[model samples]
Target: MNHGQTAPEDRARPLSVVLAGGGTAGHISPMIAIADAVRRSRPDARITMVGTPSGMETRLVPAAGYALETIDRVPMPRRLSADLAKLPGRFSRAVRQAAEIIRAAEADVVVGVGGYVCTPMYAAARRLRVPIVIHEANARPGLANRVGRALGGSVAVAFASTPLGGADHVGMPMRREISQLDRAGRRAEARAALGADPQERLIVVTGGSSGAASINRAVAEFASSGRAAEAGVRLIHITGRGKEVLDPAGSPLSAPGYAQRDYVDGMETAYAAADLLVARSGAGTVSELAATGTPAVLVPLPHGNGEQALNAHDLVSAGGAILVPDDEFTADFLAQTVAPLARDEDRLAEMSRAALTSGVRDADEQMAARVIAAAEAGRGEGRSRA
Candidate 1:
């Protein structure tokens, strides 16, 4: 009955797409966006997600209304340890599990978005002679994606500066909400919905779904010091789930313009309401900020392969974002640097322009097209083999 459903003629042929990625929102969100795009273009397409059982993908993929097949996590060890000793067996088992899932799905093509589960999935897809497409979110390619590239998969990178071989700069595939958001047109409504004053400049601070301790502490300290209010900017701070709650009642700076929440379900509203942002430079966060033309002060997470720092480089260099080292993102820095930046309307407007110039609004569609082409090519190859 749905008008979007495939017509009778188109019902006979449907492509089976298997998307592999997980562990983090950076990987999973893009995967879902691409999948959504594929469904929009081909209503009869059968799409499934492959992820680790314990990762965030378990919830996110299913919540996005896609069937998810999960395998055990098999992280590649860097040094000789007990886990390294078990790597051979664990990896073999994971690959076998992945291969079985691929076979069951009868995947026309396998697409990887780069996460812990991708290594096994990539190996399995190769073994099955299935065409593989990879999307790397970070400027620095992860180990799984690097391995996938070595396996000769079609590669797409979010940043032009990503050093992956044979990579096409397709940009990060964003959620439909973000990709289609009309920030300028909807700003008033969005702010009103959030109970934020439409006339006041707003600064939104976030640290993904798991919250960053240092960011929270620094922002809280700045707010408590009354500098944020003095700067003539309202604040919307989203401390990640299960993190320490910042109490406004305890602070003299708890003005009507300041609001805090543990999580924001409608991120589009948050993006629309914000003139500036202060947050960790995760690949997803950076991409979204750029796409929305929301100027940012990015604090790269100190751990990992330093990929967060790399992720923020292009935007920072474009004058759309400012990258601050984790150690330097203190309360004093917020007071001295961020507070002044928020008050400068001319600079914020220029940064917003730069952010839009650095972003790609149609990346979801672009990635979907690539995935569909690979699927068609794979199906043609299958027929030829038969």
Candidate 2:
């Protein structure tokens, strides 16, 4: 199907699209999903993504067969430290560099998917009079997108009801891999791959890559304390890089029966194995949690204005998950607070149903339509203005 401007007059053809921003899979994965949607909707639309040389996007983008243009733009400092000292000079140089990339790409529009690197790019796009838009994945805004949104012509958000009520509400986009799973199939797979105990409940603890020290400590303590076992729950922990009591090897817990790993690439399997998921409430994590229809206990990173907490709050309020304050996210509190839910099958089912109900299954495709529509509308507005 050919993508076109949804205007009353002539419906114009699709235009070239450029997606800029990446660091985490939260950012990179959504951008990629959006690109894929654009390609399917408008076959003639050429797409490119801007990524740093070292970020995961560098490998992910090329592997997906999309050309990546690298730019050396550093993130602006959030706190008043020595790093903040370089802001003025660094931003000045970044603006010029990003402007050059926009000119060379001859892009129709630039979209920033939250990150520090997008600062210079968006700044330059503003200066050059190019149409700019951005997608803020967090319930709380980031250092970059807060500034970028102030200057952008349009803004889209994951959780619309948050404090950032001004930007347009476009739900969180998810990768197709996570989107394809149905609850029945994933449950069976999760049971098999993780060796979940049928008589005992299962709790899956994952702290993304590099691991959350607090989450690891709390989960380990719970497993060791026998509280986890008392709940008739076996723990399956995904430690990004954190070392458990069994530090040398990545092993699941054995004291009360735990299965641990440094990392888990097969997320579909992990989600299926979990009766409850405990982890950081990152945008990607939230999207995947909703996609799989699994109940979660989210602890937002207590740093940086506590954006992760805000993200979690949005989901929790919707009845999909629970938000635990990172500082108070102790093993004692967890075993005491969360363990009770395991026995309450009714609440668990309610959470599972809520998680599935609120999910935006076709977020990528929906967002692609918005972006393409924006570009076409911008062109129309320009013509009218002229």
- Point to the candidate with the largest TM-score: 1
Give lDDT: candidate 2, residue 102.
74
lDDT of 2 by residue, 3-61 (tens): 33334433454476778878888888888888898888889886878877778888888
Candidate 2 TM-score over all chains jointly: 0.85
Question: Quick one: best lDDT, which candidate?
Answer: 1
Q: What is the C-alpha RMSD of each candidate to the true structure, in Å?
A: 4.8, 4.5
Q: State the C-alpha lDDT per candidate.
A: 0.86, 0.76
- 1-386, model 1: which lDDT tens digit per residue? 23334334333578889999999888999999999999999888999899998999999998999989999898877788899889989999999999898888878789999898999999988999888999999998999999998998999999989998889998899887886788898899888877788888788899878999988888887777777777787888888887755466643235445677788877888888888889899888888888889889999999988999999998999999999999999878977888788888899999999988998878889989999998877665542111
Q: Model 1: clashing residue pairs?
A: none
Off by over 4 Å in 2: 1-14, 77-89, 197-200, 242-244, 247-253, 378-386
TM-score of each: 0.92, 0.85
- Work out how many backbone clashes candidate 1 has: 0
